[model samples]
Target: MELFEMCPVCQRVCDVQTRRMGTFLSVEQLCPHCQFSRLWNSQPIVRSTPAGNLQLSTSVYVNGESFFKLEKVLKAINLQLFEYDTFLRHAKMFIEPAIVSNFKTSQEMMLRRLSEEDKIIPGGDLWADSPGHSERSGSHTTMDLKINNVVDIPLFKSDEVGGSCQMEKEGLERGLALLQEHGCLDDLMALIFDENFVDPAPFKEEILKVTITEDLCAQDERPVKEEVIESFVTQVKTEAF
Candidate 1:
């Protein structure tokens, strides 16, 4: 038993007992006078990439303050903090529908039989003129079925959690006000999802040019900088959600 152990959940002092659950320790505390409950368990957050080929390491922030690093990464990608909030909400909606549609499409395509016309021609085979063969006909007909095993797409991978749009707008306004107060909005563009702001685009036409290497840039790697994290934590300190 421990005395004056602050419960992380309710932030109350209590006489708590610790018990082992498998390899981990769990804490249970009772506050008889206040109907207060506090339980602490350690769990890690996990995320799978769109291709289902990679498992990304994710960090969980219990409070809104913890998401600052994620916010910074979004900002580096030309996504505004406010927009990132909106995107997260929309992503939650997109997940269910997107996964279902993709699965159905794959099922329909996979269950279909291969067509004769799609068959591959042997390298050494020569074509012969016949009733069914034309001048451009091949020596043999084979049915080639091409199966697309990859189901993850960009839109599906970019999904986010959903929140009320009205609340989001207010949050954004507040965030903007805070940024203005701190005089960081100009540099803030780098934190947003604007390619033109973060990276240099020679011209408008250059922006349209697509290269295989550029596609990989979609993945965010920026860690939420400490200053921004502290600022966000301070901003919402008094607000209750």
Candidate 2:
């Protein structure tokens, strides 16, 4: 601030002007005696967009942070920030597409690796956006139990499945369908699910009939004692390891 407030030509105090755009600051200094002037910016402009502004917006979104909360923090600190509209624009124009593309690439690589395996055992679970059967959306995620790597994640909307209660079923069905499409079902030995998950009667009757049935049928279980469940899980983990 001090350096920018002085004029080099006359070694005197100069009039300083500041313009703020989002996280970027522009400072201009002018000397009345020599009529000398200079301008400086705190950040570089990339294609007419402030680099810091775009960086802050992208970082907040990719890190699962709330822009509204960040805005409040910046305001409390008297720092300059872009508006919500700009943040949304950045997300729509750049961040979301990048995320989607990266996800597809990673999933494709994982599926390709699984295609080479003779047997694959994946553990899956459904998680809802909200508690109980009133959730608006659900995510079904499957992980390779052998490698402990996530294989796939399918998201389902309640409206598409008639009601929120059916979101879990929809997510499960979609995940299975995706695996089938990728030819991973041919190598799938067991499909592990949470003990409390809704029984997949449809899968037993329709999907698993002819495709890798032996191990899956062996794993199909009814409610049992807590100790038994723990023992079975331990056995499965030992085999996987």
* TM-score against native, each model: 0.18, 0.65
Report the number of clashing residue pairs per model: 14, 0
lDDT of 1: 0.41
Candidate 1 local lDDT, residue 230? 91
Ten-residue stretch with the least lDDT total in model 1: 51-60
CA deviation > 4 Å runs, candidate 2: 7-17, 28-39, 187-241
What lDDT does the true structure give each of the candidates? 0.41, 0.83
Q: List, residue by residue over 1-241, the lDDT tens digit for candidate 2.
A: 8887778999888999999889899999999989999889999998888888988988999999999999899899988889999999889987899988998899899989877787776567888878987888878888878898887787778898999877767766777677778887763334443433657798778865676547665777756799898999999999999
Each prediction's Cα RMSD? 31.4, 15.1
Estimate, for each residue in 159-224, the C-alpha lDDT of model 1 and write its tens digit: 121322233333344434443343434444443565334545467568678554645656777666
**Which residue pairs collide, candidate 2?**
none
What is the lDDT, from 0 to 100, of the residue 10 in candidate 2?
92
Error of 1 at 70 (Å): 5.5
> How much does candidate 1 score in TM-score?
0.18
Model 2 scores a C-alpha lDDT of: 0.83
